[model samples]
Target: MPDLWQNICLHILLTCPIFVNVWSRHDHLYMGLDHRHHHHLHYEKDNDLSLWINEMQVKMFSGFSMKIFAIDNGKVSPHIKDPNFSMYLPTIPSEVSYVNFTWKSGAKKYDYHFDRLQSLDENILKPPSISIKTKGRVPRNPKEFSVFLPCSGNVSGVAMFSIGLLIQTRKGKPLPGTPLRLTLRKECAHRGVYDRASLTASQGPDPECDKKCANNGWCNHEKICQCPEGYMGQYCTQALCYPQCQNGGNCTAPAICSCPKGYQGRHCEG
Candidate 1:
């Protein structure tokens, strides 16, 4: 009876189909297991999702040894061959932008690459600084912005890059180690400056519009200056009738000629 039971157990173990459901705890969404090489590989699921690893790849036989290993793969896609690349940052006169990055180099030198200029916000869109030409030839200023790390392949050094436009006119120098994150967003359908007008004709939080008028003038919905009683001109910077009454003439309306006893007509012209 013991021998018959042993044979029955052996037959069931060998003949019955085994179904294993494996859930991965790794950060990667898709992975592949090579049966012949006994290794695991990380696969990008964007372009080649159809060739992704199926449920059969993660299974393990009862007698097979399972090895756990992780590989750091930074390559985003197969088509882009460059692991390290150079980026030519845009130039603007007296304007400076910054980028925060990590650097790890065993080779003599490596470059930071950029595909194109993109922005996440359209209202804040400004032209790149690198494209602008300065009044004089700019001197070659090499900035020491990188933090050095001890010799370790696993460790990386953080660094900052400062893109200079106009150094003198800048509000202040940028703080080290801080970087501006760049992104690309869809273009806005409506052109020109964006402005939100309320029922009382007050300005809303539309970032594109700005109040550049001087004195008590208000910036209208079209971005034009709405001069107050005493102010005038495009930016409301000029006084309508200040000291304009030459030769002892009494000042009245803006740009209106108010002549003295001997003078007459506009500006008190004789």
Candidate 2:
């Protein structure tokens, strides 16, 4: 009877599925079997949905890059080649909205972000902008004034004084490091008095003063020196005596003549 019972048990084991756990401490036996079919059955229903969500998340965080341009006087001008990843126009005029931009990536093309017209909150990604305006008058002469001379002592106080007068008369502000041209006039005499002519003084003259004399009859503000009569030039070096002292009995000095018997003043006036 025992052998028969053992044989029946073996038959039962072969007929029914057998399960055995390599390691188990519980009285109930732990089962191990191929669960691939059950796993597939549970996953099939939600596979499409999960894949779609992953794809959407990837596209959402892809970020955006853009370029900015300026539209002025009916002409479109490229202002910024490529701006930040995303651009928002805070205070752009409505007319400027008409300005077109072509977004390109691979073989795709899109218009301005406004065309997409996503959710209002999503579309409004940038903040409002602020603008400021400032204005000032244009200056007539931007360069500074300079006084150059052959020598530092060449420019006399009188020359500087005269230059001050000229500047004052013209209401001009003198600046430093500016170039000035000193030109002697043809007619040296004005109002019956010989007005020793001097040019606008500059910072420093080239070659410096070779001769020892004040520039013109004017004394330099820095170096005040009286010009000797009849000796008139930038440095009182050139004798004013010229044109052979016309009608002179004897040419004593520049612009001066000593008359004979009947002659009187300069030019030997009879």
For residues 1-270, what per-residue lDDT tens digits would candidate 2 score against the true structure? 122112222332343233221122221111222243334333343211000011111121121111111211111212111132013112211101011111111121111111111111212111111110011111122211111221122222211100110111123432121111112111111213322232212122323344445534444434322234334334545443322234546555554566677667545655
Whole-model lDDT, candidate 1? 0.26
Give all TM-scores, in the order shown: 0.17, 0.19
The residue ranges of model 1 lying beyond 4 angstroms of the native Cα positions read: 1-74, 78-109, 118-124, 127-183, 186-270
Q: Whose lDDT is greatest here?
A: 1
lDDT of each: 0.26, 0.24
Which parts of model 2 have CA positions greater than 4 angstroms off?
A: 1-211, 214-230, 238-244, 248-251, 259-264
**Top of the candidates by TM-score:** 2
Q: Supply every candidate's count of residue pairs whose N, Cα or C atoms clash at under 3 angstroms.
A: 19, 21
Model 1 weakest 10-residue run by lDDT: 91-100
lDDT of 1 by residue, 149-259 (tens): 111112122222222212111234322211223221111112222111001111212333246667775655445445443443445454443224456665454445456
